[model samples]
Target: MNAEAARTPLFDEHVALGAQMTEFAGYLMPMQYIGIKQEHLAVREGCGIFDLCHMAQLRVFGTSAFDFLQYLMTNDLSRLSVPGMAQYTLICDDDAGIIDDVIVYRTGEIEYLLVANAINRRVVFDWANMIRDRWSTHQPCGESAPRQGIDLEIVDETDRTGLIALQGPLAIPLVEQMMPEGADIPTRFKILATTIGPTPVLLSRTGYTGEDGVEIFTHASNTAAIWRYLLSFPEISPCGLGSRDTLRLEMGYHLYGSDMDRGVDPISARLGWICPADKPDFVGSDAIRRIREQEDHRVLVFFTADDAIPRPGMSLSANGVEIGHVASGTYSPSLCVGIASGYVPTGYSRPGQKLDLQVRRKQVSVVVVDPPFVQGTSL
Candidate 1:
């Protein structure tokens, strides 16, 4: 690991467990503990815990926070009219290109917690401040400026905070053991403020894997203690980023850099569902609308390889002619097959469509399929 890479609070705990550490988003993180396959299956059949302290956390609040975010994000903030609700939204540029895909949690009447990908921490934070400044000074031609009072503030809280995820079939049951009596576990896409044993945390029922789980946000200092306490459960496995990638790939979840990026629009990435057509004008609404109406655009699709494991940047060919490239790919532990996602022209993006993946010197046949490659899990 690079000495310049930062370490999370649970870094020592991962080292104690004999994990293989690697550099990710300028952080030295665990790539695997026992093994990727074993850890992947553990989350599918039982429970697994992941250290997500590297993810970026931003706090936005004040009198005009609601209106500020309404213009900044692509999703309708009205869905989270009350506290304790969470919505997955995309932060895009004026060209409709995705800056980052984030989850916004309404923690109070005028407060929000935005969680973004670690690699995009700087970009997303800078973008937020730029928009906030623009809204505060630039007044529209005829309409009243939403930032008249300039009461909004955006703060990066990633270093001072810690994030952990407990996921699987037994995730909820295991988490309930630490909660106070009569305290209800939050449902999917909901957040609750409570204490786990002695540590106060903001628990949200959301996860990257297609499993029933909760993400706990607590003070950075309490991360190690909480991680160790959860490990006391005999069935809980300490998972690493290797298994995390595979689990999400099986669920067809979009990864920030690989699946989508600054050059890709949500509509082309199959994430248009998050952008409501009835919402008020936002930064990228016009460009996204144009992309939606255009007929000549590439579409993201999921596919399965016969025997070879595809990887990012591998070529996708039809009739021996190169077309697109794989965005994300890995072997699925639950399904025991190679699964991948890539972008291809809309004409050849349908399920059952055949494409050849160039794996090194060999060409492997692949079939496009709908997502959730390995179903029947505890979602």
Candidate 2:
């Protein structure tokens, strides 16, 4: 790809560590540090440091930050008051189509931080920019009155920060051992600001791997040194994107590009709660408004199989009748079974129902099951 290829901050470390590299979301990232299966187990049994520098970060600050975000996002920002507390939200259009999913965190009294998916980074930025502009224009003006302008700012910290996701049951203990000042790491979803050795890192008690873990964000320059230190802990292992995908999939978490997109509504994605009606307006409120007023027939179903891995786009049939196609499918390491999540006929989405998954040109036995194929106490 020549110079057109973009390298992440850990590109050198990944190569030196003999990681299998791949292009993801326009960035060259390590697909696996050792191997997908081995690394997948590493995070499941122990803990691992993942380079999440490729994700985008935006800062929404000033008095109007809160209200401005509430209008643009689906989740109620009203409940987010405590600093460093983070919650998941969906950005959607009126048609109920999800624009993106983001994590909103209150960094200060009136400031918020939004961490978005890699693929929708640019769209999120532009969306936030448009809201901020509207807020400025609509703000009321009066002397000796509270400032009306919602001072909102979206700062892209993607290039400046490095992220490490330490996931597993042993994550808390492993991170506590890496602290330089002998302070305890945050065990819950709260964010803790501290130094690992001499380098500063913000550890958030959150992860996408459906395990009890911490995802740390730090300066780009200090990533390598901090990564090396984390690896020194006996409980910490190194995980890559391949394992990360499998882990999230096992928990039935939707991957933005695969399980969802502009074409699929949030209801069909089984993420309907992400839409908050209290908000005055958002991108996809109108569509969702109509759907919620009446019973919608869209639903996301979990199909578990024993013989074959359910590949995305595979035909789903009921009594030999084609109904839908698989959106995402993978072998579950934790469950020791093949699992997939996809949109299906609303009538067939019921639990305990049976279906056929055409995997590799062959119909495989499959049964509908509840989400979170693996039980994790983290959530």
**lDDT to native, each model:** 0.93, 0.79
lDDT of 1 by residue, 1-379 (tens): 5799999999999999999999999999999999999999999999999999999999999988888888899999899979999999999999999999999999999899999999999999999999887767545453556445677879999999999999999999988998998898999999999999889999999999899999999999999999999999999999999999999999999999999999999999999999897775787989999899999899999999978998999999999889899999999888888999999999889999999999999898999999989888898
Candidate 2 at 323: error in angstroms? Answer: 1.2
Please give, for residues 110-152, the per-residue lDDT of candidate 2 as tens digits: 8887888988889889877875665454433322334354455
The most accurate candidate by TM-score is 1
lDDT score for residue 59 of model 2: 80
Give me the displacement of residue 202 in model 2, in angstroms.
Answer: 1.3
| Model 2 misplaced stretches (Cα beyond 4 Å) | 1-3, 135-148, 180-184, 277-280, 376-379
Residue 256 lDDT in candidate 2: 92
RMSD of each: 1.3, 3.1
TM-score of each: 0.98, 0.93
